[model samples]
Target: MSEKQAKKERTRKRLTQEEKAKIKQVEETHRLEARALRENWLNLDNAALIYPAIGSTEWNSVFRLSAIISEKVNCDLLEQALRDTLKRYPFFNVSLCDGLFWHYFQTLSTAPKVELETNYPCRPFTFNRKNQIFRVLYLDNKISFETFHSLTDGGGAMRFFNTLLARYFELTGVKYKNLGDFDLNVRDLPVEEESEDAFHRFANNGKCKPRKETTAYAIKGALENPNILNVVLGSVNIDALKECAKTYGATVNEFLSAVYLSVMIAEKHHSNTKNRHPVKLSVPVSLRRFYPTKTMRNFSQYLNYEVPTDRENASFSELIEIIKAQSKNINIDYFQQMFNANIRSERNFFVRILPLAVKDPILKFVYNRVGERLFTSTLSNLGICKLPAELDDKILNYHFILGATKLNRINLTAVTFKDKCCLTFSTRLSERRVIREFFKMLTSFNLNVEIISNV
Candidate 1:
């Protein structure tokens, strides 16, 4: 090789080693506490006791970053700044291991071995060659910021994006005024207090076995020309939606729930069932509301509401009233029961000691069979997103994605953008047609709706 080529190769090797050393330093500084480990185990294993089951195929979180820099952007400087920022926040650098039995922290040398992509349609939990649980992908300006959901949830990945963007600006000769204030305290959040009354009520109520499947009608349709569609979200003035709810004595959630369920019932013709079984709607209630905790790991609960099929034939006004009544009954007491039941199951020493590999398959089977029988679909309303008023003049829009649980056959994710609310419905490939038809009916009601898809 030429003298210049040999010198370039030597420089490259030195940089690689330096990067590895940096990663190791960060990992060594943030050792996991015993309480944190126990909490992590409970979240990974016990939470599967309720809701939909999670397995190796659906257990991991994914992160991806794509940048659209100005034409004058220096790629090398931008990359260096990102590396420095990641070295400061190493939690994003680790992954789970031993079939979710432990978290195998990654060193700089080990990080490069993790896979940047996966073949699964839904993000599955898996360990990388480095024995880490998460992976990151870096792309150029070819992809849009909107494409991030193909990997991880909004909550898990957004902070990393903000950090990357801030660093990029610094690399391009721009001074970041608030860089010192960007520190995040993931560990300082308060622990949730358990309610004894709630636990007692739950124990007395007995365990709820999966309900038998009802005879509700299922809707079907086909997209004439399916493609990944752009979503142009417009705010619905929260006051307007709230006023609509107040007129019918309903809360904002109940009002939206009624509208969504009405669309489903109209499309499915659920009223025709011989036994008049109710159409169920699954709502994900954030545990943060009932419990005062902010652990970044999985911390959410769900409640199911079965809307009477007869409401499909009622006037819209009447349906909204019924939904309001149902929602008002949901309170701290209800969540307490859920928490107590979950803890009761996890407290079983024998079950707690069972290896995750053995427990996972059995849990998966029961969850898929039992969960589907209880609910028709899921609704996750993340409410208003908390972002800075100004993000380099690019306003952050709404966030939504499909749930990855094994029994989560369909999910409707809603978030407020500016003043309007944007809702996205995600279903199995088999049920995509049903979702499309529901959106079509929503548009026909004069509701400004848009469709976004990965097709």
Candidate 2:
């Protein structure tokens, strides 16, 4: 053999040793925790307790978050990356299971399948042993992750998604130069607190406050196909949105919420419905800011904001202040009350002793009757996502999509990356008035809004 071939052989062996050394580093740190987690069964996190009871196979509680990369996805490399990445996020390597009284997550000793992206995003997932609660999908230049709400919320899922992207880039022989907001070294291990139930940890046993009772008006529209979730996506300049919000002395989320409420109010008037019920917006607030913990589970509380029925005719500026006032009432003390109420109900002796068969129906009934009744629409702003400079060149943009619900058919979500903010509307309804007016309103403010894509 030539001397050049011998040199190449030695370099390949050295690279293999380096990879093994990195694997050993992670195993040394995570061996004990990973072993225990796989052997144990854990109760659903506080915010997730109702999902199993409420979800169905046809429309299970799931949300999709997709990132559009500049390059096409390589299936073989993605599959290999998933295997290595799961080692860092072993908690996500679990499946849904049932207990005598409640549904739980049981760690799996096996790997999950990665699939091609479906035409419809946020496709239903099963809550049984047959399938994992989350899936990784790729199509063309896009990579989408659909997860069971019971598994994690947007924040947690975003971190996992970002890590997976970073790993995928690494596997493609990209230089490990900048990791900006991600801490995804190949040897990083899961921290213990990342798996804890934060709501229980932060619960204060105060008096449980009774939630306000008011039925919000609903949107009626022509339904799409059962297998389809209609998605409308728009991109706006982050600076332009920020400036527009500043004119009203509001944050970007507050301004968007007000716009959403304003549109619904207009829709109500246009429909000529005399119900005159309060049109409320359910705005989800991430609890990570108020707390010190960083658990990769559902840890958010939503604030229900509405224009008072008496003030229904109030102008757009007034709605902005109204949302701001409602937002101000949200802080540690407010979340504590929510935790108290939720835990108080969960800890009741009757609730605890009930069988799963008996409790499931009741939970679903409460959700449909009380929970869905309170909000006309839902909006979750996952704030801006930032990746390393290198990744910025490879990843074009990010978007968040909330799956449609029965009552809240037209829901909104926005995610920003760098200078672009993508606003996505997910609904089963074919009617486009509210969605059309939403963009029209943003453009009315002299903001440049463009349609990104639709599904």
Candidate 3:
């Protein structure tokens, strides 16, 4: 390569921060203020009903959202930034109150403190008595936000984290002219849209589809410190993953889901489990993609794809085929059916008339027998995180970790940024067979897989 040609290539690749700011100017225009309203006692949305009934010290239904920035975290600045961010997102700063018939939310008068994290990810929320549903942690150069599932899902959590980052940057004198979705200054309004219950908005009084229950293959091994969470983060090259998925004619999620199912089947065969059942993967489908709403609450549903264990020897292509077809069918109509099912149950006269004490155990029983038994595990992909050029350069990467459940010991989540797709596995059981075989399969596909474990 000639020096002149090399110089030209280098110049094109290294974009100045100012140039980065100008590149995404059009996206900055999409930012608009939202109209917000204050409410003391608000009803739980359709999706949040089951969480409280089944929640315990062990299965708290919480998740953690963390970011790796270029500079060290400043606690003072983060504290103030959170105070300001909560003003705009008041729905998150509330405590759960038990009602006669339902669990309601009451806005807290005081704000929760931001502390440095010294514990494992997805710690049980009941361990603290502050009554706040979410808490922020700072360590080294990272900022972590942990929240109960009843408060929100991944989409809402991302909004809060992004907004907090933007405000922190401003406080540190590093101003971002426009951070795209990460721009905190642009969405500075108390908009009702932010707190809207989207499931209620898109549901109807249609006959709910009766869900069929089937036993799925469960992973069993030494429980080992059952309370401890085993985390393995695999950073895969996005370009290579995309190319591999392209050849299979599947999305990244579909391809990874297939890969995950393959690992589970292989482990089952290795263990020589006598009775085999259908292997089901619980995939969360975000409702915001279909119906437009800015509600920062739980507005997502799960789509379970089951492959019979008798067909454990099926080719990767065959497993992916089933996944692609099932995932594609989860369209607007499918979501409506799911939303209506829950709404129908909530609207039932007998169910509504039942006392809270009577309803809790019934809901818990149904969840254990049907809900928890329906799927083998969960694979949730948060799509991709895109930020303005300057901010993107400053961020090392982002992670999404779902809390492990009593029935479902392992849960996997993926989020992409720039060229890296971070796939995180959170589990409670001692067996590393599933996670070990998962990355091995990725390497078999000739994709570069880097593993980082927080055990």
Candidate 4:
């Protein structure tokens, strides 16, 4: 009787095991197929490819803050907080994988490689160490949050920073009630889609004539400690600035670009170079305008605006007109061509698998040379931030630091926060008089402006 009962029970358990195994196998098959499709689509768009040559592209963003707080914020706490936060919000927790022929592939076990070297050209892309590519560095007076650009733009970063800081204060026992109100629940945030429409389009109609002559300027100064002066200039009402742009038939971006070009031209003239070649400034346009996708990967593209160097007598009004004309000419077809061309260039299998050992050196050489000759400076304008209007109460100010690109010389980043636009200029040049003069001129126009210098 005992033997018969035991055999019956064993058979029942065996059937249950078989059913579970079948279900598990089906789920695995679905996941593998989904991953393959993602890889293939990324390959077609050329969005999944990584530039092995660039050091900054590999490492996550790094921040160095002044050490003032008495309590120490350790990595363990940061890691635990991040894990809990990610569990609540899965989108920020995802990473990319390399597949053969851009099809379904196996997940790699190791963390996506993040190259961190002091000499690397670009600013560190933030990596999520706990979740593949996202990472946060907390130094005694400095905190840097770096992420894969595909996850979020500056606006997204700002939101993350605010939340992280609130969490830090709560952990440190700071008497901040707002910290409790902060929603660390990732479930509340909307998941971003990876779509073609997420990028800004350009005109691509203008002629690309060869420059008459190219000049190189070697940046001089300490790469680390360039005198960093942060000036809090007077605020400009967002509405007034918009109206000003309308009056000039230019968007807020075009107007800011013109202001930057004017400053650069003034500096070039001060150098007294006889060659009157046009000065080119690279303007990084947020792709969010053209496409609706907001996932934080390198979704931004750039356009170049050439300002006549010989315009010593050109009034600010005239310069605005030139910028308006150039900016208006940018449209969707122009960007599609660029998007298509970049995809073709990376189609070579060798380019995708090139060993970093060989690629990095070649990239360094090419980047250094191009940095000296191609563009005078980079002008990045992160348009007016549209945050939940309620944040206007406690949020004091917002600012952005320019990334350390291939060129260690100089770069300008402008972000409009609240009602004011903050323009930050980073350079290795010893003479910051040009930047000062630029601010002074703005003041002369009765645009309440302030200057902060690292010099």
> Of 3 and 4, which scores higher on lDDT?
3
What does candidate 2's lDDT look like per residue over 1-455, in tens digits? 89999998887677877797898888986997777766677778888998888888788778988889989999888888888878888888888988899898888767777799756888887667646799999999998888989999999999889888888988887777756446765468778798899988888778666886689988877888868888889999999999999999999999999999999998988988887788999988889988999798999988889887787788889999889998887778887898789988888999999999999999999998888889899989999886767787888889899987767888999999989999999889888899999999999999998885565
Question: Sorted on lDDT, highest at the top, how do the candidates line up?
Answer: 2, 3, 4, 1
Residue-by-residue lDDT tens digits, candidate 3, 45-65: 889888889998666898988
Worst 10 residues of 1 by lDDT: 142-151
Clashing pairs in 3: 34-191, 35-190, 35-191, 35-192, 36-190, 36-191
| 366-396: candidate 4 lDDT, tens digit per residue | 6556533666777776666543334454344
- Model 1 whole-model lDDT (C-alpha atoms): 0.49
Order the candidates by TM-score, highest first — what do you get?
2, 3, 1, 4
Q: Report the candidate with higher lDDT, 1 versus 4.
A: 4
TM-score of 2: 0.90
State the lDDT at 40 in candidate 2: 78
- Give candidate 2's whole-model lDDT: 0.87
Model 3 stretches astray by more than 4 angstroms: 1-39, 127-130, 179-183
Candidate 2 residue-wise lDDT at 278: 88
Q: How accurate is candidate 4 locally (lDDT)?
A: 0.52
Off by over 4 Å in 2: 1-38, 178-181
